[model samples]
Target: MRDQEPAPVERATRRLSTKETAELLGVKPETVYAYVSRGQLSSRRGQGGRGSTFDAAEVEALARRNRRESTPGSSPDELSVRTRITLIDEDRYYFRGVDATQLAARHTYEEVAEWLWTGTLRPGARFTAPKESLAAARRAVSALPEHSSPVDRLRVAAVAAATADPLRYDLSEQSVLGAARALIPTLATAPPLLRATYTDGAPIARRLWGRLSHKEPDEASLRVLDMALALLVDHDLAASTLAVRVASSARAHTYAAVSAGLGVLEGPLHGAASGLAHRMLVDVLDRGSAGLVVADELRAGRRVPGLGHRLYKGEDPRAQALFAALEELPAAHAALAAARDVVATTARHTDLHANVDLALAVLTTSHGMPAEAGETIFAVARTAGWIAHALEEYGERPLRMRPTGHYVGVRPPQPLPTQTGRE
Candidate 1:
């Protein structure tokens, strides 16, 4: 005997029309057809062939994947990437199951990076560079113009270091970690290693401070910088992290993957946000009123730069943590007041809240660093994150992030013999 057919209601519950599927996926009708074409969601013609109907379960799965893929602009809503390094919740960030805020407050950037690279936060984790790589990095930086930005110098140094390292082709876990360890210090422009007895062997943050500033290092400021770097070590899969992963998925070396990440970070909406925030802060400082500057910017149809985040509904935890650190220093008073004023004014006028970019701007300028220093900090700190993501992708199936384009161009070429003469 033939099997019984399911009831109409049951079938209706399991199926969705094209329009309904488009709404469910937050895409257009064309996108629904493309999904069907790509086999992401199965579809069949309706009775009498009027419209397309999609499997409801498949549409729902695609919706979930789209949501997961939507992050930080550069990552399009197509591929769902999985990572165990970091998780961004509504109000908190976790790095390898540990609260990033807690880790930021107490740990060095090296320790946080080690934790992200491996699941364990071993106290013995160290970041040191070989002498040959250091020389290559110095040569690369020396070759750049005097006006080159920190990130620019770092990028050149990265390429040079990669070229110099004979073992850079190794994709082994330990070998990759070793290259990462060697690469970061070079990128930071650390002074040449003399001897174990002569060097302070300070943490990454302190060494970075020395590289970026001419002023003598303050212990308190260095501590805050360490916290900032720790907090920024990883965040889910940011656009740059996704870029790094995409490169690593193709079996690219750690330096190559990081170079790809830096390319993404150079975008205005990504790593350059800190510098933009600094400009906004300077505007407030020059105008002598944070509220006035913010209101004027909004009136001019511009957003108060760095005042809000898409992911954080209230305040970004990184911002709050860095703000708390700022509050500890007397020198940060003006920057803190500007930040609070912008926050309060924006909150009164709109739903936005202060984010890490503003906090970073405040931290840098308040300490007498240039406005662009914030971008430098972000780039340096995020290098660790990109490397961690590259490592994660190296373990996955190679080239798995290659996404198929949904063709939306004109139809295929066809014979038009008679019409062609008229045209």
Candidate 2:
């Protein structure tokens, strides 16, 4: 297939904010959108999803562009991001052009990680942690305060792993993958909460399960955990992945790039998505009425977390596959009931559908794990993806992700009018 064409030039005029664009077009702010939807104008999403910015040149030539008249079902306005990693389309997600849901069924997490990093499926890839690396991670985790969250322990472990590796400075594809193979497992096993005695050479999913829960997880639940890890291996250029690529583009080592990704992943708007969803599920189970809880949240003008996603027009396929898996487990019965009720109730009141965060929340809580367990799983799984992105970015021009800011601050060298000497 041919490469996607570049997005329209990102000229200075296109960088105008909503208010500026509205004034430029001599129309109300709302009407500016009417023009965009009609394709008379084009805009791209601004940083951090604050809003869209219009093309100044395109706005100036709007009359001429509109004369051609677009066909009934033309492509919607979108930013052209070039990558061979993952694809999100029509409510489904694919990794390396393979359906994620289908791949999750028969593939182990390590296998998927190999495929993402190398572009070929190697079923028996081993992601082994060195004894010395594990020791370093433990020391790092111990240095944190006792009350640190599991994710905090993970961050410290990442730094420790990087510092211990003398060869981490190499940025070759094989070198980066080798660093990632050791680093991910160290992060997973280093956390005090997840630390436990296990035989060497265990599958990552089984070893991880021992750390998350005191009870031994059944074989079926282990399979579920494996699938969850595999499915979350990548998701295009999410905010955290963007951070990884940015750090890599600047020639940072694999460890430094991953540290940047983890920093962004901890934000409430990113990796914490599953934790928030878990709280919503807890509220329903505690209140004994899913409908009442949903209604109250909506009445208070708060969004019911995990019920909707910006990417999927219908139910997130990941959620659908996970919910189907939950159906076969007796332990998930109560949590599943509450989850389904929330899904149905929200459907009646809004266009939102259940997303992957909700599915992950249900999976953890229903299996008698802590509410924060989902985030831990997410962090570990996404580490592979972050490494994959960092490798991809290392091949591109350096520092390309660095964006120039439109200065809206006060002008330089302006005199203070009050003569208070405040510059």
Steric overlap count per candidate: 0, 4
| Alpha-carbon lDDT, every model | 0.79, 0.81
TM-score of each: 0.77, 0.78
Q: For residues 1-423, write the lDDT of model 2, one tens digit per residue.
A: 999998997755437787887666555576577567645668899899989987767776653332222334554343233578899998888888989889888789999988888878897776788888889989888888988887788888899988889999987767888898898888778655554635667777877886777666788888888888988888888899988888987989998999898899898777888888898898999998788888787899878878787888898888888888878778888888888888888888678888888899888888777777888899999999999998877654455555546789998898777655656
lDDT (0-100) at residue 110 of candidate 2? Answer: 90
lDDT of 2 at 15: 73
Q: What C-alpha RMSD separates each model from the true structure?
A: 12.2, 14.2
Candidate 1 lDDT tens digits, 1-423: 989987766444577988888777765576576556546678788889999787788888777765554345555655667677888887888997889999888888888888888777768465778888878888877877777766687788889899889999988778899999988877765332222211335577766776655666578888898888888877777898888988987889999999898888888788888887888787887877787887788799977788777778889999999999989888888988887777887777588888899999888878777766777778878989998888766654455677768899878796665644554
Off by over 4 Å in 2: 1-80, 193-197, 416-423
